[model samples]
Each structure stands twice: as C-alpha cells, then as structure tokens.
Target chain A: MKQLVRTIVLSDSYAQSSQNSPELEERDPYNRLLARQRGIRLPAELIRDNALTVSGLLNPEIGGRSVKPYQPAGYYQHLNFPRRKYAEDLNENQYRRGLYTHWQRTFLHPSMKAFDAPAREECTMVRESSSTPLQALVLLNDPSFVEAAKALAAESEDILDMFERALTRRPTAAEVAVLEELLASEESRFAADAEAVGQLLGVGMKGVSADQRSQLAAKTSVARGILNLQETITRY
Target chain B: MNPYFLDHLKRRTFLENSFTGIGAVALAGLLGRQESLGAPSGIPEAKSGTGILGEKRHRPVKVKRVIHLCMAGGQSHLESFDYKPKLAELDGKPMPASFTKGQQLAQLQKQAGKLKCMGPQFEFTKSGKSGQEISNVFPHLQKVADEIAIIRSMQTEQINHDPAHTFMNTGSIIPGRPSMGAWVNYGIGSEAEDLPGYVVLTSEGGGQGQPISSRQWSSGWLPSQYQGVQFQSKGDAVHYVANPPGVSRDAQGELVDSVNKMNRLFGKTRHDPEIEGRIAQYEMAFKMQASVPGLMDVSAEKPETLERYGCQPGDGSYAANCLLARRLAERGVRFIQLYHRGWDHHGGIKANFEKTANLVDQGTAALIRDLKDRGMLEDTLIIFGGEFGRTPMAQGSGRDHHINAFSMFLCGGGVNGGVTHGATDELGYAAMEDPVHVHDLHATMLHLLGIDHLRLTYRFQGRDFRLTDVFGHLIKPVLA
Candidate 1:
C-alpha cells in the first residue's frame, strides 16, 4: 500500500509548478482545478527531518522505539499516575526522525505540538497545519533546532554554502541578506554577553566541536536564522 | 510589509459570517467533520473573532456555560456527601444475607461476601438556612450549603478508576466517545476569540490520584478543533506559551510577521482553504500570546480576594485554578473543566480523604460564591463530584468502589438550590428511590444548556453516539 501510494504521488502530474497568473489565482484559490502545485509548510515530522538530513548527523537507522530529544525540564512532571519524568536521549537516538519523539498524551513534546501535530490519542485524519508564534519560537529557541544549527555551522563557515547544504538550494539574494543581518547582530549581541553564546552552544546532549568560541557562535547564529526561514519550514 | 489590513481583507471575516448566515448548522457542521471525508464543504477558512457563528438553539436555556470540577479517583460518598445514620448504628456488623445474596458486588478482597459495614468517619450536621446535612470534612463548603443541590443516588456502570472517569466525562465506559465539553463546544460554540471554546485545567492533591490523559477531554469523532485545550498551571501557562529566552517581545512580533508573510505567500499559491485557516489560527495564537499571559497574571487581584480563595500568584493549587476558572468564565469561554486529583481513598479513609477534602473545599465553595457575587451564577452552571463513589463497607481501612449509589452536587445552573434529588437505602448499599444514572445526569446537563440529549449526536462506527447514549431522561426533579 505504501509503495503504491508513493509511486502515484511521485509521478510528474503530482508535482507541478504554482507560477500561474493572478487570474488563475482568483478563479482557483484553493487550486481545486490542478492548475499548479502549491507551497505548504512541511508536516511536523519533515520539519525535524529536513534539519537532521541536511546536517551529517541523521542516523538513517529506521524502525525503533521512540527516543527522547532535548526537552525542557519538568515538561512531563505534571504527568501523574506515578508521576513520569522525561529522560532525554544522549546517544544517536536523539538525532532520529521527529516521529521518534516520545509521544506522551497528556504532555506532548512542546516543539512538535506547536507545529500542529495532534496528541495521537486517537486516529487523526486531517491534521491541522497552523503557523503560530509558538512555531516560530520552536524554530528559534528549541534546543533541537539550536543543535541542528550548531551542527550545520560546523560544516561550513561560508553563509551561501551553509544555505545550499541545509536547504538543498543556493541562497537567493534576499535570503542571504536575512542570514547576514542575523549573523552580524547575533555576533555583536553574543560578544557583549558571552554567557549567552555559551548558552546557545550548550544546548544539545553533545557539546559543540572545539573551535574559536566567538567565530563559531556567529556562524551558529547565521545557521539558526537560515533554519528559521519560511522556506526551510515549508515544502514548495 | 503592511501592518494594516488590505482593504478587501479587513472585512474578510465580517463578509464571511454575513455571507454564510446559515447559523449553527454551519457552526455544528464545521465543528464536526470526518478526517478522510475532509473538512465540510463551504466552511469559510477564517471568521471574524472566533466566537460561535450563530448557534441555532432548540430552545433558550437558563444555563449558558458550565464549570465542572472532576474529582478524579472517586470521592467516598459515605464519608462526605451521603450520611447513613443506620450504617453508624450497625458499624462493624457483617453484611446481612438480604443485601449480599443475589447481589453481584465488586470485590477487591478475598472475602467479599463477608465484608463488614463501616460507619461515617466524619460527623454530619445541618448547615445554612436551607438545613442540608453536610459532613465535617468540608468546613468551608458548609457555608454555601443552600446554594447546592446534592444528588445522593447517582449511579454508573464502571467501578474501576480509568473507565469510570471515562464514563463520567464522555458518558461511555468505553474510550473514544466525545467529552461533554466537546459536545457543548460543537453545540453552542465558544465566545472567546483568543481562547478555545473548551478549556481544561487539571490539579493534584494528596491522595491516590489517578492519571489523566487527553482522552477524557478529547474531541473523539468530532473534529479536533472542538477538543479541550488544557492550560498549564505552571510555566508559561500553555504549551510553548513563552518566547524562547533571548527573543524580546518586538523580535517575537517580527518573527510572527515574517512567518505570516511566507504563510500568506503560500496561501496565494494554493488557495488551499487550510492556508487561510492557518493564517487565522496564527493570528489568533499571536493574540493569545498577549491574552493568555494577561489571564494568568493574578497580581492585579485584591489581596483579600486571593486570600479568600487561598490562591498564591504562581502556585498550581486547586484554589489558584478555581480563581483562574472564574476569570475564564468572565471571558466567555464556553466550558471550563477543572480536574482535582487524589480523591481515591481505597484504604485508611479517615486520614487520607480529609487531606483532599480540605484541599478542595475552600476553592470549590469560593468558585460558587464568587460567581453568585458577580451576578454570573444564574448563567453559569458549576458541577462538583467524582466519577463514582466509595462503598459503605470497609476495604482494609478504606472503602471499595461502589457504583450502586454515589453522590454529586449541582450549583447555580437551572437546578433548585438547597434540594436533595434522590435517595439511597438505609445501609447506603443501593439507590432504592429516585435513582439517577450517569446518562440522566448528562441529559439534564445538556437540557440545561439548550441541547436536546438525543438531538446532539455524532456518527462513528456506523452508530450514532450522543452524550446520554439513548438512555437518559431529563432529571425533572432537580430542575427549578
């Protein structure tokens, strides 16, 4: 069933360009007529996948028990019936797919739920995909994202190369400017509060690779900003 | 980017509501949709201020909203609400063959039929002008005795913790039924724009508190939008409520705007109705970022009021949640379900049950008193009870699960105040007169809320399911 579904969706008719005229835009606002393919924010799983896959860190191992990524402390403390405690994974499991995160019904992992993932208590049919400030917060502050940014920054210092590596496309001029400004501002901010840089670098189970702290911190900031791009979270 | 709305988009919500003037059929049909069947046809992506899109009621109801405090782990009826003077007279006596024979009772002990009858650990006396006999366990609740209608003969099928709670909230011992809160949301819709129609708040006390999951308050077959949102008692108050540490409020706004820019861009490409829906949700969530924090902050409240409710600013106690519930009621949230756990006193009933009673008594009474003081009690229905009640016989030092007869209380809905609805037998073993089943309670609650119990239903697994499950009658005696 899975192979058949994938084969049908992989066909050319399934993937079309959305570059039609404004008239076409108005007439088929929901694209019901199949004029072109529309851009969409990626599903909760792929949002995490795109980050890990771009960096060399994705484990590529499949079919295992769910793993615990970096979540805030006392996140699951409220979960009773013999109160549960979140045990974050420190090994390769931490880099697994978003699907591998521990699925607690009462207390779901904060970042994934922000991306409109249901609590998974029952069969969910049409999952609502919402773009909220919480989602932006997840992209910006969640340790998983921070860790991904640090890993991507370690791959390359050049901004354009980093974008190509993560986004699988060369950076557009406008996108480059957003990244550059974030990098410059974050560098100055972190330089003043070196403790803040230490904090960003201190996110994941694994620590940052040994390098000049200030330079790596700036690069990490740039990578973090790029990862927060609307394009990064969306599928065109 | 434009901070103000584009001329066409400014009144987009107004036009949508005005255009689809079909009333609650539009709202009801929107709140419920099969996932594979897809979102209902012609449902607008976004509406102005996310209140009900005109709920078409069966009739005008006196009770406009509800506040339910679900006492998880059943509260012991014999010790608290139902006072059996005969049981005290016959304390430590073996169960008579007349009551035990031919009756298949729940047994957690090896010698089930030979169990000894236990008397009430606490004293009961008439309280308030109406003279209802409340136990000594709740000193604070005694003051508002006249404001409540106590049901002494409430019955249910489930005797276990999980299933019983399931039955109480969703009207089914089996899982996967839509909760009462969800049904109410689908029926009348929410009034708050920045909050969900059905909001849940859960707290813990010092007994054998059961675990609460999303299932109790889930939307079931209803679309997920109708499901309850459990606001947190600590931290940022809701999931992902706080901005990441370093980002300032302006930066958060910038981030939301930038993200919205792309979402709107994506919407233009697909015209996917979900895109517009997503945009609306993002804006609502953005608005909620400000509103939720404001709602959680109780610093502006008078010190005496906080002291009266026994609520501290940041503590997630039952008192604090009760205070928060009133604030939510004021904001027009359709349903607020607060769950206070640790009521299950299986053994050592005297010592353990008192702790939970004290923990909740003040806050529960204060909620009713506060609502009445604010002139909101007439429109707001408040229910206080557990999933089931405990037996008259002792299990070790505590009581076992008893479903033959239990107790629950109603206040400030359309029910008569200071009234006792039903009666149980002398030994408190069973409801011999005016018995009210779980379904009947559900029916009465729905009737009070302007929904016909049979009329509100969702089809799942080829069977239509309502909160009362086709077996409930309007509890007429309790109604004013």
Candidate 2:
C-alpha cells in the first residue's frame, strides 16, 4: 500500500477573493454580521464531496447518519394575536370589531366593500370558471359594507384630530376633501330612512327621558367609522 | 442530471473527460436519452387546451343541452300524476297479500299500526290531445302533457332520503360521485367560455325541507375546477367582488392587468395546468366585472314575460330561477340543474301538493313554452322528477316513502313526446311493465346528449369509471 501526504492550507487571498461586497454600509450591526456570513463564498462542489467522505467515514454502515423522525429540517415561527386582559372588560370599539369579524367560508377575510377583497378563493390551476354579477352588486349595496365604509371615514376624522392634537397642524385640503366625500357618501347611503337611523341609534320615535344612551350609541358609530378609514386601515 | 455518476464526476478532476468504466458510459448514455426523448402521449403540451385529453366527440344526433329539475324528497305520484282508481277502491283496506308479497319495505310503522290504503287526494282528469291523466295539483303541467314523455315505472335502489337523493343525483347510493350535471359537463367540455358548463340554482326560502347541497352538483373524482357553479340569484350573487372605495373602473382594470402580469411571470416557466387556469380566470374576472351585472339584469325582459312566469326581477325565487335557467341555456350553458325541495308530504297531501304545484307549475310550464317558442327546445333537453315516489297506502290518511315505483317526464331534445312509456301496477306500488331503473335513466340521459354511456369513461385509481358505472341500458322506445 502507498501512503499519500496531503497538506491543506487556508489563505487570506482566497478568502478575500470569495467575499461578496456589502449591499449597503448603513445596514444595522446584526444585519452586517448576517450579510458577511451569507457572503462567505466557498467552493460548494468541493465542500459537498469532502462532507460526504467525512460523513461516510464517521458512519460506515451506508454513508452518513440518517435523519431521525423527530428532527425537522427547519423551525417555523407562528404569528398570534395578543389576548385581552378580561372577556367582559371589552369596550365598544373592541365589541364592534369582534362583531364585524366575518366568518368567510371559502376564501380570505372580506374587508368592507371599500377594501375590494375577492368574493371567494380563485383556483388558478384550471381553465374553467364562473362568477355571477350579483356578487358585484351585492358588494356595492350591502348594508354591512356601507356601515364599514362609514366607520372608515369616521376613523380618518379621528386620525386628523389626533394629528392636530399631536403635531399641531391640520390634514391637507386634498386629504380632508377625500375624507369628507367618503363620509358624505357613506352618511347619505346609511341615512336612507330616518326610521332605520332611529333603530341604529337604539332610540324610540318619541323622545325618552333617559336619552343619553341613544346619543352615546349614535356618537359611537361615528367614532368607529372614523377608525375604519382607509388611512387608518392602511400602513402609510 | 445523472445523480450517481454526476456526484463522482464533480469530485474526480482526473476523470473529467475519460470514460474509465462501464458505469460512467452507461450513466452518460441514460442522461443523453432522458433529455432527447419527447413527451409521452398521455400528457399534452400546455396552453393548447386540446392536450389535457382528446377532443370530445359530439354526435350530430346528440341533444345540445339539458335542464334537469329535481324535486327533492319523494313526490306522491298518486296525488300528482299517477292517478289510480283501483287505489280509490281499496281505500281504508289493508293491502292484500297479493299486493305486498314481493316488494321491499323501507321502514316499518315502528308503532305497529296497520298500513291503510289511500286513494288519490286530488281529482285527476285527462288533459291534452293524448288525454294523459294529470291531477289538479299540476294544472300547468297538464296543459303541456302532450309535449311531455311520461315514464310512470321509474324505480331507484335506495329508499332513505339522503341515499335516495344521492342515488338519483349521482347514480349511486354513495355520497360522493360526479353528479349527472358534472358528468354531462365532462362529456361535453363546455359551450360558454365565460360561464361554467354546469350551473345549479335552488330556491330554499319558503321550502319545507333542507335545500339541495353543493354536493349534489360536485364533480367528484374529477378536478374541483369542473364543479358546478352555484348562483344565489339574489342580493350580491358572487361573494367579495365589489370594487374598493375610491378605485375607479380604469384603476381597477390596471390593477387586474398588474395581477395578470404577475401571473404570467410565474406561469411562464412551468407547464402546470393550474397556472394556465389562473391566467384564464383573471381574464374572466375582468370581463365578469362588467358582464355578470348585465347577465343578472332582468329589466331587459318584458313585463308580459315576467307576468307569464310570475317572477319578480330581483327576488330570488324558484320562478325567477326558471327564467334565469332559460337565459343561461340561451347563453350556451351545457347543463343547468334546478332543485326545489319540500315535496315530501306524509299528511295534508292535497294542500302541500297544491302549494308545491302553485310554486313551480306555471314557472316550469312557462320555461318549456318559452324555450319552444324561441326554438331552443329542439336543442335543449328538459327532465323533471323527484328522488322517489310516495306510497299508495295511507300512513294516517297520507303516504310514506315508496322507492319501488315513481313517475318522471322528459320533453324535447329529440325525445318522442305525446307518449307514455312504461307503467305502474293498478295501485301504483311497483314498476310493473317496461321498468326503468335509475341507472337506465342515467344511460338514456347520456344517450340523448350524444355520448355512449358505456364508452364515456374517466380512468381513476387504475380503473375506468363511468356515469352509468357497472349498470344501465338505454330505453330506445322513448327516443324519437
């Protein structure tokens, strides 16, 4: 048998040649280290061969150690919503949001008509498809969507007020105009009948002595509507 | 591509161009062959819709389309169409041993009360030139009797509600199978490019029982892409298709175009049908944003036509659905299945039948008459039947489940009209002469559609399955 002598060496020149240029110098310290690790260029082909040979030597039965059933290739981090402190302690805002949470059966959560989400899950793989016009009409006229739109407009007003309180400057004329039109349209559609408005306000046709409850309810809808504005919903 | 030798080739610099061993030579040869070989016959090239399968054979003699009206639950034949005077004579008497001997019992009275013979609850009179006996419950159907081909000896395998409904809709006692509409859709690819080939419309607002489920229109074993498209016909018909607030029509169009571009970018590399399907769906979605509103806009229909069918424009009623079905048929939908439940009447047979009759009789007749006047009846097939029929004997002066005998009718689509084929016994208990099984009816339906039921097969799980799986024979006597 002949014995072979092999010398392995690491050179700075080779390492420098393999290093990738940084995307930006302004990257955070943690990101910079991660970028350096990612940019380390090695001959993957040679590394793979050496790995196989080393693995084969360590576990001689076949080649390398077999994967166990319990060990996964990678871990997945799940996103979860924060829990409320108490079930009965929910305010009107929280209650309204919860009630508006739609139980969408076949597709993504339908945001109010103002958001323009798809009606159902669209299967992309097959050529054949069908959709009814009624869906579009429904979205245009549904009371649920109308209420959501109104809430969104009111939310914008609240935001503008908050901005004035914090920044001490009013929202631009363009922004205010858009918000006003949205609010007006929503208000007009919702005010189709005075009886309906009375019902929503939770008040009787005849004035009652303790009418503060009805006034509060009516005010809450406007506040909630302001909260539901596109500006409020979208992350600008 | 050759994993074994390629693994060694990458590491062995000395063996780069040298064919040192039989393994290297063999592997290289295999890799070369793999790249050069063309696609097999089973899988067709993408984008060319023709390749998924062979071109569907549509015989010139075949009926163009079908509109099936399934009255869910059992419709009492004696109270509706199959008027038996003999049952009137045997009223209040226990069914003689001669009558009850060979029949299968679905349910025992549980309380051990003797079954009493019941006569027709409503008066039956001869109507039309053919003098077909129709009960007063279906005055409108009686008017169109001459144009109808009634089959009074219809029998199905199952007796229970769910299974019987399943058997009638899917040709099997099992819950999952391609429905008759699905089968028709598969046989003929589709006529309308925008709409689905098979459509289901149901009116569940004022019915007595549960509405027909989407399962009845499922394309089981076939791709979910082939399932029947359901139309609610009222309110917002499609779910979630409204435009966003402040988004103009042009802006929405641009957004759809952007989405379509993204789809095309992802779809270009792979030959997946799903990606292709997505591309097609986007185009439809954009067009539907305009067409669907127009399609459901029944204001174009004249006031007289609406009055004839007794339909309201936006109300989601069965009568409106019938009018919609005719419109869909005109739009070239291959198959339309309409279901109206609540025919199961064990008591107040007269009143219940009258209610059901009033709800559907005029609308159904109007559909046929309208189709005929428009010259669509020649190409469109019409079929009306229930899951099964009710018993002749009264279970408290009414009827119980009877799956052994029933009545169903078909018209137009080259069928011999003004004729009654097959018959029930004098008491309407069992299929006595020219018996037509549910399988046979399925076979006949496919036959009318220009498909050879035996030949139309879809291979699944290494076995060929058909609409008339393992059984069926077309009744030639009913064909013109």
Candidate 3:
C-alpha cells in the first residue's frame, strides 16, 4: 500500500508536469466548476473556452434570458455595466459583468472584490493558519456572514428532518436531555424580548431574535450542537 | 497490526502474545506519526527567526507606524514632481525614432500627434531653502519640500492598471502574496489589542487611481488577522457591524461566556489551532462592536481639522479618507494604506491632470502638517506615489505609462530630507542612474521601519517568502 501510494504521487506529478495543462484540465472538471455545475444552477453560463461569452441556462426564449457580456476592464477604467430592459421586472435594468474576458491571466475578479475571494497566486497550497481574533468576529457579526449562515441553515432544515427519519432507535435519556436543554434556552431567549420586538414592528414576533450578536456568544456553544444535529454546514 | 494474522501464532505463550501485540501496535503508531508529521516545515518563522510570534525586527525602529498615500491610476511626474525643460524645446515635434526603440505603448501612442512635448502646464518654482523645483500644481506639498525625499527614478514592472496596482500592493505582479501592509502587521502585531493592526481608507471620488480591493491589503499566507480592516470615510465604515436585535450588551456578554466555556472543552479534545483564534476573535468582535463605531465618527473633530483635510463631516471622499488615516495612525494602527484613485489623465491632459493634482496635493500636505503638529511625524513614515509614471513623450496630448522611471516621495520617519536620490534620462524616458525598482523601494521602506526585507520572511510552499521576494536592496543614500 505504501509503495502504491508513492507510485500514484509520482505519476500524478509526472502526468501534470505543467499545472495548467490539458492533462490536469481533463482530470479535474467537476471540482473546478463552481456554482454553474450540476447542482447549484447559475442564471447565466460564462464560457471559458476562448472568447468571453455569456449564454443563458434555459431555452433560448421562455426562461432563456441572456445578454451579451460587457467590455473588458482597462487600467484606470471606471467599472461600469450595461443596462438591459426587462418588461417583467423594473429593477432588472442593469447588472455588472466580470472584469476579465473569461478569467484573464493575471487580472483580479471584480466579484472577488465584492465578495472577498482569495486570489491564489504565489503557491498552490494555501495554509489557513488561525492566529487573529478577527476571523471569528467577522463570521459572527459581518452582515455577509449572517446572511450566509441563515441561508445555509434554511437549506439544511430538510436534511435535518431526514436525519430524524432515518433513526431506528430513539436517543438515550442523556442525549434527549441535552437537546431539550438547548431548545429550552432558545425558548427562554425568545420569550425575553420577542414581544417587545414585535410591538416595535407593530406585529407579534414570530421567532427569536435572528441578530447574530445575540447569538455571537452562543455560536461556539451551539456549533457542536449544530454539527451533531445532522448537516455540517452542508445541504445534504 | 492485522489481528487476523496474529491469530496464526497458536504456539505463542500468553506473555509473549501480550508483548508482541503491544510491540506491533507501537510500531504502527510510530509510522502513523510520521505520516501526520509529513506536512511541510513549521509554520514560517519570522524572517530572522529570533522573536516570539515574529516580533523581533531587523533593527530598533524609530517609525511606529506608516501611512502610505497611494495615488492610483498614473500620477504624472511631469506636472507634479519631475520638471523637464527639454520638453519645452521639443514641444509639438515628432519624437525621434531612436527614442522609440523597443518601447511598447498603450493606446496613447497611437493617438499622440507629431510627438508634441508640452512643457509644464503649470509654473515651477523653487520651494523652501532646499530650492526643490516643485510645480505650482502642488502648492501645499511645496511647503513641506524641505522635509521630503523625492525619488525621481522610482520604477515598476508593469504599465497597466491591475498588474501595476497588484505589484505595488503585493510584492508580485500576480495576486495572492501578502501585501506590504499585511506583512507589517505580521511582523509587528498590534499595539492595540482590540483593533486590527492594519487599516485601509479611501477618498470619495472612489479612491480611483489605484485598484483598491481586498487583495491590496490581504494577509495572504499569514493568518487573516493581519489583513487590513477597511473603514470607509462615510456611513458606518464597516457594514453589518451594528449590534443585533433584542440582545442587550450584558446578555451578549453572557452568551460569549457560555460559548467560551464550550470552546475550552472542545479545544482540549481536538487541539485545533483555529479554535483558539475563534475564541480570541469572538471577544475582539464583541469589544469592536463598541469601539469601531466611535473610531469612525468624525463629528467631534475641531472645525480647523475638517477644513485642513478638506473633509466634509458626513461625506466619504479622498480628503475624508486622508484625515481618517491620521486618526487611525493616532489610534495605533501599525499600517494605514490610503488609495486615492483616478490619476490616469490620458485624455484631457491639462484639464484632468491639474484637477486630480489639486484634489490630492492640498489634503496630502495637510496630513503631513497635521502629523508634524501632533509630534507623530518623527515616528510616522509617509509614502506618496502611484504604480508608475506617465511617459516623457506625449501620447496625443496626454502621457502614457512609463515603467522605466517615475517619481515617488517619502517623508518623515528616518528618510533624509531635501534630497533626490536618483535621476532619469534627459527626456525622463528611463532611469539614467541609481535606478530603483519596486523591490528596492520596498526594501528601503522596510529598512526605515527597522525591518530587513530579505530577513523578514514567512515560509510558504516549502520556501521562505518576503515583501521584496528574492530581489531587493536598501538604498543607503536615502537613509538618514
């Protein structure tokens, strides 16, 4: 097994002598294809083959709403996008396209700036060393983080129900007690000011405060509870 | 250790069986340990590998902080710092074919008419006792000319916006390396425990000239904590930083205590390094929720300061960002990078270039004066320049990108004042003597900060990396 592992490693590097060659391209397609792949559907498909082109995902007419990609960005150029008229939605007047003509060689992505995506340049393997207190803070309090967490939780709720369905034997008394304690805490927190918040909004509160700071201190305490619940930051 | 294979030892005594089983398991454990240890060398030590958490710098530094006023796009050397008399002699004449040798031109070349070498659109006069010939365009910067070190031969690797911006910010023309600000944060952690070490500010015309993005101030291989925290000059600088609903500050504290308790238990079991970072960040975030909003508020500033930086109290602009940078510097932010973009005056050379210069020059001079008044100038280093310079020859009426040579100004800290360390050719086409590449400039800046560029390294991908990246030399002439 050791010798086989060594052989595999050697052959892999030998086959991929150049990191960005056709060999590696053939070997990995699905992993490299993000969001626009089989599962998570992208509204428009950006063809990366040669010319920068944007094609619609649906049939050419009905849901096949596609517009031509905008011009590539130049040095010191204003990042502006073209406007499109849609009869159905007044808000769909303009949308900004990416900077590259399809991932230009050394240029940065505008979306990467809008969304802080790591620009992998110097090395292939980036080490995620945990040192600063900012990372967790940003995750807990950054509005972007709050939105992502809520979206992720909502999507994974169905999977959580599936975990409950697959159970052949009920949990032990201790396990049941632990879950009950968590639910009880959530209930108590909700009871504290749900009515007050609802009154401010001129409606009764439907749920506990979704504010992350309220949950900021509770994130880690409930992280295990969350991970053990069924889905681990994943939909399935 | 395969249990099925051990079963074949029928003749083995009970004691022998016990000994052999234990030995087999121990051997297996040893092999597994090596596999786990196979990760590349220890997390990169400090460049010199002498201090705890990379705190030991190359020397005892005088500069406690740095505020780099990055002029994005291309700030014209001709109109601002570099004064060329020969351009007047060759005004509207064709650029000699000999001068065009091997030079690639941006769209400006195709549009340039008969190589019109227009002289300074604005007048140039000697400023202060140093007799530095600064253009009238920078009336304010001229006041501090005696305290500035202007390097007219400063050059870069690229002419285009994205690459040049990336090269200036990070060491490489490519993205993903730690930015200079991030490196400073990594080398010298933070004086303030609650706030971030590095902070970024931008001017209102959208910090146009330089490409200001997360990559410009990213921590890269270093932990994300070292990354610059961007605080806008307008409207609650950081988004979603407001306190959540229904949670009193005390209630929030209680929740944090509960989370920390659980984390302590999990950390003991898993020994995850990130777990500790998370705990620290959570506490910092809680504290930041109170401090950050206060820090960004400028309503308390005296009217004089507001007029000095040309800042509108509630508006976000370059002038506002410049003043905010000073505030952050006072608050102990190790590195404050300000990007004021829109300097590329390719079309309306006279009209556009002059306008952009007016926008920056006054505010920049005010920052220097403000720092000096506060007694922070002595220990605070300030850098002002763009990625590269505009061409010596005309591109139509406007100048194109000239990477061969340009100008940059350094003031305060340990830089020698009233000096121009290098020179460009007669036409200012290229560096004639004492050529300083971006790497060399980086080295010299680090040197002023008491950091040796070569020695200040972070190991990444089995090799040590640095801001200068295998090539950089401290220009001893510029140092005091």
Q: Which candidate is the best by DockQ?
A: 1
Q: lDDT tens digits, residues B63-128, model 1? A: 888999888888988877889999998889987768666655666446667888889999997888
Q: What tier of docking accuracy does candidate 2 attain?
A: incorrect
How do the residues A1-236 of candidate 2 rate in per-residue lDDT, one tens digit apiece?
12222221243322332122223212421222323221211121222122222112111232222221110011111101232122121222221222223323332222221122323333222211212222222223233333332333223335356324322446565545543444344345434544534444331112223333333223323333332222222111
Where is model 2 more than 4 Å wrong at Cα?
A: A1-236, B1-58, B101-113, B205-207, B239-241, B248-283
The runs of at least 3 residues in candidate 1 whose Cα sits more than 4 Å from the true structure, single-residue gaps closed, are: A1-143, A146-236, B1-55, B102-104, B107-109, B245-284, B459-464
Query: Per-residue CA lDDT of candidate 2, range B216-293, in tens?
Result: 676665433455767655554454454433334554454344434433433332212233333444454555566566
For model 3, how does the per-residue alpha-carbon lDDT over B333-359 read when each residue is reduced to its tens digit?
788888777787676688777778878
Tell me how far the alpha carbon of residue A123 in candidate 1 is from the true structure, in angstroms, after superposition.
18
Q: Model 2 chain A — which ten-residue stretch has the worst lDDT?
A: A70-79
Candidate 3 whole-model C-alpha lDDT, 0 to 1: 0.56
**Model 1 steric clash pairs:** A29-B271, A30-B271
What TM-score does the predicted chain A of each candidate obtain versus native chain A?
A: 0.88, 0.25, 0.30
Residue-by-residue lDDT tens digits, candidate 1, A127-204 = 544444456557766778878888888888588888888768775565566666666766676677766667667767
Stretches of candidate 3 above 4 Å error? A1-114, A117-236, B1-55, B108-116, B204-211, B253-283
For candidate 2, the chain B TM-score comes to 0.83
